[model samples]
Target chain A: MYKLSISDKAFNVLNYGFLSFVLALTFYPLIYVLSASISDPAAVSSGNMWLWPVDITFEGYRKVFENNAIWTGYRNTIFYTVLGTLLHLCILLPCAWALSRKELMAKKAILWVILFTMLFNGGLIPTYLVIKSLGMLNTVWAIVVPNVVGAWAILVARAFFQQNVPDQLVEAAKIDGASDFHIFFKMVIPLSAPIIAVMALFHAVGLWNQYFNALIYLTDQDMYPLQIILREILILQEVGGDSAAGAVGQTENLLEQAKTAELIKYAVIIVSALPLLIVYPFLQRFFVKGVLIGSVKE
Target chain B: MELSRVQVPSTVRRETRFHKIKKRFLKSWQLYVFLLPALLYFIIYHYVPMYGVQIAFKDYFVTQGVWGSPWVGFDHFLRFFDSYYFWRLLINTLLINLYQLALFPLPIILALSINELRLGVFKKWSQTITYAPHFISVVVVVGMIVAFLDPQNGLINNIIVAVGGEPIDFLTSPVWFKHIFVWSGVWQQLGWGAIIYLAALAGVNPELHEAAKVDGATRLQRIWHVNIPAILPTIIVLLILNMGNFMAIGFEKVLLMQNSLNLSSSSVIQTFVYKSGLLEGQYSFAAAIGLFDSMINIILLVTMNQLAKKTSDNSLW
Candidate 1:
């Protein structure tokens, strides 16, 4: 039977106390936002909605879903994430597969080139110019194509292939007169389901959160993703100020826009974030493994 | 030692090495075929952009192609160096990275505290909650920060007024901007950053702790001697890895957080480039600034890596 000393007990109490404190501190802000989204706009604006909903109303959520631009942004974001991740896998998986091979010619040189680009890029302006030159700006291809290579993703996938897919399997396939391409496509890809899923999820989440590229590349509002449009709405609210709330007119005026915008900010936050958050717990197990594998090489 | 050299003739050695390389290439050309798409991607996207970096030295025009553009050697670079915003951009970029580096060990501390727990719900919940914020978008994070820091109606202000203190508008205040940005970053990244150290700490042999217990070492002593040393290499590697991004301050978040009132402190190199190049269409000037930023990062990374190697005798190489 083991018994903790006074010092150990003190440490345990302190540790548990700090952990709980952080748990509350990190979680309470999110709860407040969720509660505010469901509360009356006036209640939220007055800072009355704290830990729970005040004068519960679904007005904010209703307006957000009804907005055509927001809906289009959602559609665009989904398409980008799906198509972007597929392109990522098509480029990344094979690169990883080939690089992981001990027999691949110029492997060291190839890896050096990849790693060199990883550390130093041509900077944002040059990259943007290159994309613009390719006539990809404002197109869906701009959102997905130039984003084909993620250096870290390729490195992680390569590391996974090296560690998990054994040399013995490749050699066995070779002895059976199977080509290197056949071995990688048939044996390697199937055996690497966990890594593939992890890579896909990681890439998809990144693409879903993407707005910076769109901010620069795409000029049209209809082409805007959810994050960008939401940001614009947020910026509009700030610029509109208290006048937006006080001013009323015959049209859908500044006052109405202000109230709806305030509510919609919270609703948009929840809507954009909900899918990833819901999938996170299930992906948590894979991510832990994925991150650990990636970091260990560094 | 001479007998162990296998007595191969020098002429035959070259032939064998050549033959071995040829055999491997003949057996593996199919893998090269697999590599073509990725190779083309790198050439088109990455290498082509790299080629375009030469535009920083030229008076670029859409009418004239890259090679046809007249070169004004170092004009853009000189202009950037002499620009009024140069020092401010440089300092702001450095300070943000400095704070990030200073705060690097915090996640390790969080992990250490969590590891101290024998096992409990607190451990599970703390891990889950801390990591959740990392997934939130930058725009939402800035929105939350603005809402929470609103001078008249924010929660913090409400608490301040309740306690008979003055409410401060944190987001708009220049003094408060860096703190808000840095601490919020800590909040978001704490768990994700700790994952590697936690993995390392978990890999520590339990027998070492048991041995320390038998030797009458206290809990603090055990953690300090055992856990700290175990994760030290990981900590250094991550530090070096982070230093590699010394110039990259996640332009997205800073861009989101920047307002007219807080532009003095919030306008980093990245934002500067975005504003100048993307918004104002001064492509050459922005590219020059961007090129300078990359150079600074590379230098810092190399220096830090050297220092890390000298101090700890560990390196990425």
Candidate 2:
């Protein structure tokens, strides 16, 4: 073992110290939001909330839950995520698998076309115009289909297939008189569980975080996703939605409404992210693996 | 001559190539069939937009349609290029990018720091907390920012006031805009970005570190000599990609954070394009600006890739 000199000990102390700060820095904002969410509206508005809740209250939670728009947003987001992830996987996996096959003719040529898009996009307006021309605006397919072919995902999934699913297995299946389709369905798809999970999680999380698509394509309030609705409460201060339905009967005062609106943003922040945070720890390992697969080609 | 007699005809050559292609296609028809859906998707969703890019040159009118629209040549592009807004938007974007690029090495440093921690529990906990914020929605993240920075009641302002400093309106001020934008971004992405470098670090040869230790090198020296070199390829590639994407800032978070007070600093090419093309309905003009932006990006990416290839033999291409 190497002897620790004074400078070495100093370096060790600084390293741990900086990392501790990083832990606190990353963690504190989230804690602040959580504390603000439960704190009394008066306390929140007065900046009394800190490391923990001040005058603990669920006024924010109550407001977030009662809102019909939020429920609609939640439902629409779920609909988008599930269907979109499925559609993404359906289009992505088979293509990736095919590309992974060394025998697949002109793989490089096909990948070149895909990679070309990543290098040079037609920019936002032209894409929107294309969507408009397709009459996909204000529709679910507008958000889902337009975002289906991510070049990174395709490459990652291709690399994953190539790495994980051995070519020998396909050859063995072929020797057993299994057709290409049978081998793909029976052998390849089953082995694809990890990549599938990774893709699904990524696509689902993307859909969950999605609002820009809704902002552009869908104008209907009914079609808005949770993030969009959350944006409204957070930035726009549009409180005609359900979250304020409870705050209604008690007070019509401007001061009271302002406090409610302030409280609601914190609540909305927590409520909006609660699902991902709840699910993420269990899926953390998978996420790290997925990210590595996406980023590191080898 | 015998040599001339052995030479194949051009038609024979072409026909053999065609037959070879046909045979290959027939053999791998199933793979092609599997790829058809993705290809169709790329054609419809990706290529079609590229085709729509020509409307940037055309005097695009919704009623006339893309085909029927008059060919205005570079009028829209010229209009954008000539406008005073062009310089402002470009400068603002470049400055922000430069600022961000300056901070890009933080994640690499962070990963190195995390790797140095002998305490396993703290290391795992540190990583978990740092990584947790990435999964949060932009709305929630921005919302958290708004809450934490709220002038009257925000935690930041409260802390500032407690320490006897004036509670500056961090969001609205143009001076604070880049700092808030970049630092918040760093906070959000620090851990997630570290993952790639950490993954790279994991591949560092243990023998090299052992040799360094045997040579009585310090911990920091080992990291500098062994760990950094091992991850240099990954870092260079990421740097090249980041430089290539200099103009392509995340429009969502910026749009959310933007206010009229901070508009001078916050306005970038994408936001400007969104305003004109989507909101104000100057589709052709917006498309022209967008087209110019993408052209710059492609040039940058190609140039950077070529440079990296020449210098380090590590390029995206």
- Tens-digit lDDT string for candidate 1 (A1-298): 5898999889888887888887788888899889988988787767677789999988878877777777888988998888999999988999899998887777777787777787788888888988888888999889888767777777899989988998888888889999876887789989999999999888888888877888888998778888787776665553122233445673557557755666687887898888887888777878788788788564
Q: Please report the TM-score between candidate 1 and the true structure.
A: 0.93
Which one is best on DockQ?
2
Compute the lDDT for candidate 2: 0.84
Give the per-residue lDDT of model 1 (tens digit) for B1-317.
00111112343358889798778778788888878888777767777777777888998776785657789989999988888988888888889889888998889999998888767776776777788888888877887887788787778898888789998988778788889999989888888888888889899999999999999898999999999998899888888889888889687899988989988898899999989998988888888889988988898788888998899977776
**Model 1: DockQ vs. true structure:** 0.50
Model 2 pairs whose backbones collide: A63-A243, A67-A242, A67-A243
Task: List all candidate RMSDs to the true structure.
Answer: 6.0, 5.5
Off by over 4 Å in 2: A1-3, A243-257, B1-20
- What's the C-alpha lDDT at position A88 in model 1? 90
Per-residue error (Å), model 1, residue A263 = 1.9
For model 1, how big is the iRMS in angstroms? 5.4
